[model samples]
Target: MRGGKALKHYVVDAYSTIEQNRLYYLRSHQENLWSELYYGLTDDFNRVDVTGDNVGHVVLPSSYTGSPRYMKQLYLDAMVVVHHHGSPDLFITFTCNS
Candidate 1:
C-alpha cells in the first residue's frame, strides 16, 4: 500500500489526482534544493526538452517512469539493474488480477 491507499483501483481519476498531489508535496519539499542542484551545473542545459528542465531538479523515483515528471528515472533504473544484475538479456511485461 502507498499513502494509505492501494495502487490499482477502478477510481483512476481520484487515484491519479491523489498521487499527483502527493508527488507534488514531495517535490515541493525539495524546492530549496533547486538552486543547489543548478548552482555549479551550467547555464546551458543539456536536456532536449524545455518544459521538463525548467523546474531545475527534482530527483524522481523509478516508479514514476512514463509519468509527467519522468526525469531520468528509466536511466536510473537501468543503471541500478545493470550494476546489480550484470546487464539484462531480456525483458517481459505481464498483467494479472488476483
Candidate 2:
C-alpha cells in the first residue's frame, strides 16, 4: 500500500435469508477488488423466501433480459490512482470518458 493519499471506491454485496435474518459479507470495501461475500440465514424474509425450514439464496443479477429491475444494485467500484511511482498492480481501474 502507498503512503500518500489514494482514490478509493467501495462496493458491497450481501446475502441473507428471511428466517435467520443474518447478514453476511461484512468487510471493508477497499481491501478486495471483487464484491464482498456474505451468508445469511435461509429463512430471511426481507431478502429471501424460506419454506419447509429452508432459506433461499440471494445473489446479485450480473445480467438480465426480462427487466432492468433485477440489476438495480449490481455494479463495479472503480477509482483512479493519484500520485504513484511507476505502476502498481491493480484489481480495478477507472475508465476515462472521452
The candidate that wins on TM-score is 1
Candidate 1 RMSD to the real structure: 7.6
For candidate 2, write residues 1-98 as lDDT tens digits.
55333322211122214212322331222234234332332233455544765433344223322223234323211112323343456868689979
| RMSD (Å) per prediction | 7.6, 17.6
Clashing pairs in 1: none
How many clashes show up per model?
0, 8
Assess every candidate by TM-score.
0.35, 0.16
Q: List, residue by residue over 1-98, the lDDT tens digit for candidate 1.
A: 46344435546878789889967966887655345443324444553456854765664443564654355656777799899989678888999999
